[model samples]
Structure formats: C-alpha cells, structure tokens
Target: MDYDVIIAGGGPVGLMLAHELGLHGVSVAVLERLTEVDETIKAGAINVPTAEALDRRGLTPALKAAEERNRAEYLKFVRERFGESAGPPPPPVKFAGHFAGIWLLGDRVDENDPDLTARGSASLVSGVRQQDIEVLLEERVTALGGKILRGVEVTGIESHADGVTVRAGEHAYRCGWLVGCDGGRSLVRREAGFDFPGTPPEITGHQAIVEMEGHEQLSPGWNRTGTGVYVHGPIPGRILTVEYDGPPVDRDTPITAEELQASLRNVSGADVKVTGVRSATRFTDNARQATTYRLGRVLLAGDAAHVHSPFGGQGLNLGIGDAVNLGWKLAAVAQGRAGEALLDTYTAERHPIGAWVLDWTRAQVLLMRPEPRALAMRGIVSDLIDTVTGTTYFVKRISGVWQRYDLPGDHSLVGTIVPGLEFADGSRPADHLHDGRGVLFDLGAAPETGGRVRRVTAACPDRPDLGGLLVRPDGVVAWATDASGGESPERALDTWFPPDRR
Candidate 1:
C-alpha cells in the first residue's frame, strides 16, 4: 500500500483529516488537483465547533491571530464606510451570526447558557477565511510528515477487500482506505457508487467582490427585497444576491461584470453597474447527502458526503466537523486498534448531522423566497429572531454548540464534546488531546486502565460531582460518571480503544 490512507482533494477538510491521521503515526497522503490554494471566496468564518476542533490540535494561537487580522480589516471597512461620522467606529460590534438574512446580535446572545459557557474560548465565532484554514491545515499536515501530492486528479478507483487502488490517469496509488474530500461534484463518490439523493436547487445566488457604480443605492447589510435578498456591505464592495429564478445555467462559466451588475439590479432594485469583478462565484440551494458515508474500503467526508446552500455559513463548519469525527476513527482502524465495525459509527453519527444541515439550509431557502407565503413566513421568522431567546437559539444552532451525538450511557455529558474544563494543574483538557489520544480524566477515585487512552488524575473544582470522564480522541465524552455512582468506563474503553492487540 502506498499509504494507510489516501485522501482525495487537498481542501481544508482533506488537510485536516491528513493532520489527524499523521498525528497518530498513520501513513497518509493528500491528492489535490490544484497546485496552489485557490483564492476563490468561500466560507468567511468558522463556527464554535470548528474553533474547538482547531483548539484541541493546539492551533489556538493561529486562530486568534487570524481573528485579530479579520477584526482589523472589518474595523477599517467600518470606518471607511462611516467616514468619521460614526464616532470612532463604535468599537467593532461583536457579531454572533445570522439566520437566512436575519442578523443575530452577539450582545443578545445568552452567554450564561450552560452549553455556551462550557465551550470556553471556542464559544465565539472566528472570522477566518476558508483559504486561510486550508493553509493552516496544510502546514500542520506537512509538519506531521504527511505527503500532499498536488496536480493529481483522481480519475477512478478499484476497491478490493483489503485495500483500494486509486487511478489518476496512468498512475495507480494504493491505500488501505480512501476518503473523498473533494467538492460537491466528487469523482471518488461517483466511482465508489455512493447513493446521493436530495432536493434540487430552486434559487440562484451570486457572491462577489467588485468595483461598481452607484453602489450607494443599495442598502448596507442583508436586505430582503421583493425580488429576493441582497447584502451590500460589512466588507467593502462584497455583495451577495439571491433570486428564486432557478440555479445558474452554467456554473463553470466565469462570472462577468455585466452578469453581476444585472443580478445586483434584479435583487436590490438598484441601478448599480459593476465596473470590475475581483472575484465571484455562483451557488444554489441544491441540498444533497450520501445514503451512507462509506462504501467498503472507500469513505466520504466534507462536501463529498453532503452538500447544501451556504446559508448561515454552515458548509465549512459541517465539513470541519466531518473531518474531526472521521479522522481519529479512521486512524484507529488503519493502525489496527479497532475493527471495521467501528467505522460504521462514522456513518451513524455524521449522516444525521449532514441531513440536518441540508434541512437547515433548505429552510433558509424557503424563507428567502420572493413569494407571498414565504414573505409572510420570513416576516414571522424575522420577528422571532428579534427576541433574546430567538437570538440565543439561532446562535446555538449556527455556532454548533447544540450538536450532541447519540452515544450510549445515560450520563448527561455523554456523547457531548467534553467541556474545556481546567484541571487542578491549571492545564485544560484540550491541552492533553494534542497528542491524538483519548483521555480519561479522574476527577474522583477512578480505576486506571492502559491502552491508547491516557489517564490523568486531576480535580475539576467547577464540577466536583463529576467523578471521571472518558473522552475520545475527537473530544466526544464517551462515558462520564458522578463522584458517587455512574456508568463504568469499561464499556466505552473496550468499545473505542480496546487493549491493543499486539
């Protein structure tokens, strides 16, 4: 085998998975069609779960630096737009996120919510572009000694009982497992014969950064118009328009300045004339998901597994979650620490979340429709989103703090991402997970077991009732117990780590 794992597509998800696999000492390689990272404008920010995932990998400093840079750019944009009249930029508003076109103010978010508070520093959204994330992951992957082969497009695959052969033209690369992290139109998924079924697109959307005439005619921020929805600014010259006319006739064709101008006119009802386009892309509300994430030795993640509209900026976050969830499990299997049955859990856990994301984006598409009923519904949703409770609820959903896997064991924290609890030694749990191993936190008297799992004896003053926690490498609380009595970690340990069979 050329590698234990061969990842198709060197996008953010692929690189992240490569990093995880490499951290576990698994031989891995990432095949990317592009020689260099594309500067195409994609997701502009990451949700809380994604932030937490990066933090667990000890990439918090990088994330913070990127966030600060984005904040500075945003402040500059604000000052330029306000032009000295807005009183020193008003200290840069903390944005939580948005639902459809409705903005969820960060100030309105319930910070005291148990779920939000538990996430620690990861609770806030980080304004980092998709390109930046790919760069970061690529660096990490390279540092871990993972190979990234660029300009190698996967054309076909032949899956055997033990391994798979990936064909890129005349060359063949063999690996024990193959993961398709390619985009929505994935060749790996097609070759592997994964059933992709979902609703077709109803609306066409255009996002672009451009130089235009009469741009001031369009209002700033997300505006719901009679035609559709259009956003003017937050970033200078960045415009987004949605129209329920149908998906783009040809997505591959480059977006022309005239085309964007016409779209701006249609959605914003403004006489805006786009003079030049710096960058542009077309998208649709075409929601789809694989019937299952795996097909024998070949698996899927990121846009390969599921796809939906970019509503609420969920695409990157969803893809990041997929990488984080699949990475450790795949590493375990490749290293012979677990059986093939463990891979089944990947589909069981991620498929539902993928389905939810599809539905969530579909709902937003419904709200953004130009029809009368949709307008009424949009008004109602907007009203609901105005209240503090509504803002908090939307923040939870958009931030990904509400996601909890359906794992066994009745402990409340089970199946949830273990809180970023600070131990008595002043080190946090995330600090311990950087080595790519599961951790057993012994808050109270808990039996110590050895395998791949690391047991740490520490007291968490915040929750004295919590005796111990068995956290997976991916950060999910596999099992938990109270100081007095709770389910034993034997079941989870045996299920996930199992004594290494040498």
Candidate 2:
C-alpha cells in the first residue's frame, strides 16, 4: 500500500491529524491497535487553541453539540447530592479558549471573572472524553475523504532514502513520511532508534469506572489532593477516569479495592464506598522526553515524543498540537511547495515546547508525591489560591498558551499567536490557511511575489501592526511589519519558498 502520510496510532491526536490533512485532500492512513472507540476517555477536554484549531478545520460544531447535550444531563445528576451549589456553578464559555481553562472545565468551576483569564479556573478544566472525540473525528475524516485501518498494529518501520516502509500484520505500507502518535512505548520510535529519556513515575495511579450509589456528589469532574488525580467525567450514564498517585501498588501490579478506598479516605477524608469496579490498574507519573523528535523520514508526536504526568491533561492535547505542526509541513514537502529545510523546524519548534510541558507536569506531579518539600509546595499553592497573583503562572499550565518556541525577533509581533481576524469583506484570514499552503498578508496595493508565493490581506485592530504577516501552516507568523514598503516579509517568504519563479 502507498500513501502520502501514514499515522501510527488511532488515538485522538493521530485521528485529528488525519482529519486535518484529509480535509486538505492529503492522503492519510491511521493505523490503530484498538478496534473500537470504547469508553476509555482519559483526555476529557480541549482548550481554546485546540478548539480554534478544530474550528478552523470545521469540527467544533459537533464538539459543542456534544458538550451541550452532556451539560444538561450532568448538571441535574450533581445538583441533588451537592445541593444547589457544589462549589461554583459551571460558567458559559463560548469564545476560543473556553475548555482550555480549568474553572468552567471542572465540576464547580471558579466563575469569578469571565473576561479576564482566571488562573484557578484554568486548572479546574474538565470536559470531553476520548471516545467521544475520536468518534467525532472519525466521522469527519471519512466524510472529508480519508482512510482509517483498524486492528493494524505497526510492528516495524524502515525509512529508506525515498520513503518509509511499515509492516503491519503482513501488510507492507509504504509512505513518503510517517508520523508516530502511538503513545508512550511507541514501536515506531523504538524501531527508529529514538531515545526516550526521563524519570519513571515516582507515584503509581489506578484509573477505573466504578459505580457508587449516593456518592455522585463526591465524584467531582476531577479531584486533586497531595496524593493524586481522580477524574469523574460524566458521560451521562457512565463515569470515565484517568488517575495518578493512586493505590499503593507496585509497578505492573493490579489495583486493589482496599488501596483505592484508602486513597479516597486520604483525599476526601471520608470512607468512600467502592463498587462496580469497572477497570483498575496502577500507573506512575513518570516523565519522559524523546531526545529528538525526527530521524530522517520518521517522526514522533503525542505520547510518542513526550510522556509526562497527566496532571494537566496535556498528553493527548500536546500530541494533537504536534500533529497540527507537522501534518502541513510534510504535505508541503511532499508536494514540493517548500524545501526539506521546513521539516527541520518541526523538531526545532515543537521539541522544546514538548520538553517544557514535561517539565511543568513533573512539577505538578512532584507536588502530588509523598515527599516533604513537595507537600510544603502543595500547601503553599493551596493557601495562595486566594492571591490571584500567585495563580498567574499556572494559567499557562491550564490555558496552554505559553507553550511556544523562540521566534525570530524581527517581528516581535510575529512570535505571538496570530489572532483570527476578519477583513472588510467579512472574510476570515484563517479561512485561506488550508490546501497545504502558506498565507502572506499583503498590506500594500499589490504584492510582488515573483509568482511562487501567494498573498492575501485582511484588516483588524492590529492589522497595522506590521507591513504584512506571513503565516506558515502551523499558524506561526513567518514575517511582517509596518509595510515600510520594505522587503522583510518578502525576504522571509524567500527564506522558506525561495526564488522559484516558474
């Protein structure tokens, strides 16, 4: 079998990447080990940036609809036990970064301020389930002309000079480029000889979908204490979970009911009745990062590149970000629109951010550890919550807006995230970002692109911020400025597109 891009792992990030590229008419194949979407909804929510990424690609409506339906049924279930108010009623978040913030994301989210970014709320985020997200993405990808091959576990990958050859159960799939979203312990990364380095989880956790009567209120969307994380995501009838710092069990040991109840006692200070033990297994908050993200034609993403404590729920989200970053560049290179040099930027730009995410998750996990200094820091944080200033740094942890690599200082404005803007004609500047292409904002009357590059213009409050901003597929502003009728944006274009005037 031949393809443009073959994504190993049918998880959310791999599926999302496939859908994104398939929308652009890029041939993508998702090889997943699982046969069904199921109810292992570990990643329960997505943030503003990820939502916008989905929105730009036209998948937000299904997500919003699903959330709306889930909200009505969920609010009623909690109200009876927790009274009219459990903590803080959930907030209405309709803008870009809603789910990314923790406040409205949790059971009783902090709705102190809707306009100003809230640090506490950012940490309290909870919503969405992996199965639900995958179902939505699968339907979308198929509708947009993509292919998904299930029950195909990739056993090996051999990157030749021309492309990559993948072996999946007697199926030899060859592709120009390969993406590894296969989670931690990725077979592709191992085959490619990429090193995964970091500390293994100091604390182990067990996740389950147990049933408990009269304890519905006790099961908040997620409960965090010095011990670990307990997610109580409402899939209406069922509750899914991804936990850490769980039962006192050794590595690869089965979770015991006594351990779970004991941890519950420590965290909630109550003898929580445990029943209907659906699934239980111990997991450590091990933090790891791949030495390099790319090796020739093989690349790693999601849990493949970095696996950290799931405290921030960044495991799946960060992998999707990696997909969003690489899908286009691989497409561009395959189609010969850009040089191979563009591929180098994938690791250069994303690896650092991946490492940073691991570091932050490690810090959060450390606080959950049984260490004295860690407990002190955790107490410091708990007491300091009222001081909004003390919560500012964590806003990035929840919001995910702070995870970015260095940008060329030329357009200090360029390094920042490009706010989606509308032009006089009611056109969204982001609408033209598809089709495996780059966008150049031409402020001047006519662009002087020598034929190889394309330019379009849009205006907004900060449109005057630069001559014109050049944006790459991953939404990084390549170049821009006060249009001093000068040559920087054009120079930047040439830097990537080069002087190919055909």
Candidate 3:
C-alpha cells in the first residue's frame, strides 16, 4: 500500500485525523482540492469536550491563544455597545447560550472559568474559528511527518477486500483505508455509494461578514420576526438570518452582498444596507446523515457523514469528535495491531451522537418557524431554561460537559470522561495522551500492565474513588478500578490492546 490511510479533503477534520494517524506512526496522505486551507470564519466555538481532546494532544497553548483572541473581540464589542455607564459590564454574561431565540444567562456558560464545573473544575471551551483549527492541525500534521497534498481533487475510488485505491486525476494512491472528510456534497461519499437520508430543509440560512452602515441599530441578540429569525451578535457586522420562505438554495450560485442584504431585511424587518461584503455563504436546515459511516474499506467523517443546519455550532464539534474517535481505532487497524472489528466501534459510538445532533438542530429549526405556535414554543423553552435545573442541563449539553460514550464496563465513570485529574507533579493525565496512546492511570495501587498503553502514577484528590482507570486514546474511560481493583486493570488493557499475535 502506498499509505496506510488516504484522507479526502484537508479541512479541520481531515487535518486533525491526519495528525492523529501520524501520532501512531501511520503513513497517511490528505488530498485537498483547494489550493489553501479555507480561512472563512466558519464555526468558532469549540465546545469543552473538543477542547479536552485538543488539550490531551498538547494543543492547549495554541488553543488558548485562539480563544483569548475571540474573548478580546467579544469584550471590544461589548465596550462599543455599552460603556462604563453599564456598570462594570454587568459581570460579563453567564449561561448565555440560547434555545430557539430565547437567550440564557451567560455566567453559567463561561468557558474561561477552569474551575467551573458541576462537581469540580472542567476544561474551558475554546472559541476559535474552524479555519484556524485546520491551520493548527495542518501544522501539527506536517510536524509529525504526514503528507497533505493540496490542489488535488479525488476523482475515483475502488475498494478491494484488503485495501482501497483512490485516484486523483491520473495519479492513483493505494492505501489500506480511504476516509472522506470532505464537506457535505462529498464526492468521496457519492463515489462510495453511501446512503444519505434525512429531512429536507425548511428554511434557507445566510451568514456573512459585511460593512453594514448604521448596522448598530440591529439589536444584538436573537430576533424572531414575522418572517423568521435573525441573530445579531457579540461580533459586530456579522449576521445570521433565516428566511422561512425558501426553496433550498442553489449552492452553485455565489452569495453576493446584495443577496445577503435582502435576507437581512426580510428576516429582521429592517433596512439593513450592506455597503460591502467580506465573505458570504448560504446554508439550510436540511439535516442528513449517512446511513453508515463506513462502506467496506472506505469510511466517512465530518460533514461528509452528516449535514445539518449550523445551529448551536454543533457541526464542527461533532466532526472533530469523529476525527479523534476514528483516528486511533483506524491507526491500530492499519498497523495490523487490531482486528477489523475494532473499526465497527467507530460507527457504534459516533452514530448515536450524530443522530442526536441532527435532532437537536431540527428542534431549533422548529422553534424558529415564523408562526405564533413557534413563538409560544420558544417561550416555553425559555421558561424551562430559566429554571436552575434547566440552566444546568443546557450548560452541560451546549458546552458538551455531559458527553459520555457507552464503552464496556459496569463502572459509573466507565464510558464517561475520566474528569481531568491533576497529579502531585502538577501535570495532567491528558499530558501523557499527546502520543495517542491509551493511558492506564493508577491513582493509588499501581497496576502491572503492558502493551500499547502508557502507565502513570498520580494522586487525584478530586476523584479519590478512581483508584485506576484504563482510558482510551480518545479519552473515554474504557474501564476503572477501585482500590480493591474491582475491574482488573490488566484485563481491561488486554481487552483493548491485547498482547496477542498479529
């Protein structure tokens, strides 16, 4: 095989996957049709779980810098909108995400607070543009000696029983596996004949950065108009407007400044004139997911596997999750260290998450419908969200503090994020995960274990009950043991990374 894995599309998902594969010494190539990584400000909020994923790989410093830039921009906007007259900026906003058009309080959702957790300190959500994430991933991929071939479009794919062949024009690269990380309308997905089925779009959406003269009059929050919903935000001149009267957009047509202005007016019922357009794009509420993430030797990730409205900024987060989850499992298989059965777990674990996100976006679309019933529903949701219980639930769900995988084992912490444990050495267990190796963290009694696992001894004052934990490369707790070793740490290691014949 020319490479162990050939990834189509060098977006954030593909680049991050390349880095993950590279961490495991897998020979991988990324084919990107674009001459350069897109710099468009796509999704910006990297939820907590994803931040933890990046943190595990020693990407926290850069991630934190990116997030700080976003926070600065947010503070600037708040200052321009409300000066000292507002009295200390009203303590910044808390629990400030929204359901439908109803805004939640902001303090509860602040990602910068490391000590902000239901039980203890949790990882902060990183607020960086998706394009910036791709750039960072690309740098890491190159640093790890992975090859990313830009301006190369995937033209053909042929899957054999043992390996797969991908053709970009006349050049054919053979690899043990082919993964489509391309966007929605992915050629790889179409060529692989994966089944994509979901609900059609109910409304067309517009996002753009433009010079809108006197645009400050547009209220800086979610607005439900008679026609649809429009969100003016913490970022000035950035607009998100939805129009209910819509046949799905012809994505082939470029979105112009004039077109975006019309959308702004229709949705906001305001004469928002766009003097110039920096960049504009169109999307829809059409939610779809591939029936199966893998088809034989060819697999799918990111937008290729699922497409939904850009509601609540879930698409990018979901795609990144797929990359991390699939990366380690695929690398193990490619290195002939694990059975093909290992790959099946990728779909099993991620499909439910994808399905849930699709439904979540659909729910937001339902609430945003331009009708009295929709308005009433939004009020109901807002009321529910105002309660302490509702506030905690949304904070967890929106911030991804509640994400848990159903890995094997009966322990409560099993399949859940093994809460970030700080040790006596002032280092985190995640610091050892940078190499993409499963971790056997011994909190008290050290385990006698071996094979594709990194063993560490630490004192976790936060989680004293966690005597030992077998953490997957993806950071999911595969197994845990109390001081008595309820679940043998050795058995858990053998189950995931067995010391067996290749």
Predicted model with the maximum lDDT: 1
**Tens digits of per-residue lDDT for model 1, 1-502:** 9999999999999999999899999999999999999887788888878888988899888888887887776666666566745443344223377788777776777778887878766545488889889889999999999999999999999999999999988899999999999999999999999999999988889999889988768787889888989987667788999988888889999899999999889888888889999989999999999999999999999999998999889999898899989998999899897888889999999999889899999998898887889888989998888887888888888878899999989899999998978878888888889887899988885666654577888989988888999999888999998999666788888888877655
Model 3 agreement with the true structure over 52-123: per-residue lDDT tens digits:
888888888888788788777777666666663443245424334666766677644545443234322226
Off by over 4 Å in 1: 84-95, 106-108
Q: After superposition, how far is residue 460 of candidate 2 from its true place, in Å?
A: 2.6
For candidate 1, report its TM-score.
Answer: 0.97
Model 3: which ten-residue window has the lowest total lDDT?
113-122
Q: Higher-TM-score candidate among 2 and 3?
A: 3
**Candidate 1: C-alpha RMSD after superposition:** 1.6
Instruction: Give the whole-model CA lDDT for all candidates, comma-separated.
Output: 0.87, 0.65, 0.82
In order of appearance, the predictions have TM-scores of 0.97, 0.83, 0.94
> Which whole-number lDDT from 0 to 100 does residue 170 have in model 2?
89
Tell me the lDDT of model 2 at 491.
Answer: 61
As a whole number from 0 to 100, the lDDT of residue 243 in candidate 2 is 37
Would you give me the overall lDDT of model 1?
0.87
10 residues in a row with least lDDT, candidate 2: 93-102
Model 2 alpha-carbon drift over 4 Å, by segment: 83-126, 214-269, 277-282, 382-385, 434-436, 444-446, 451-453, 461-466, 483-487, 499-502
Evaluate residue 252 in candidate 2 and report its C-alpha lDDT on the 0 to 100 scale: 56
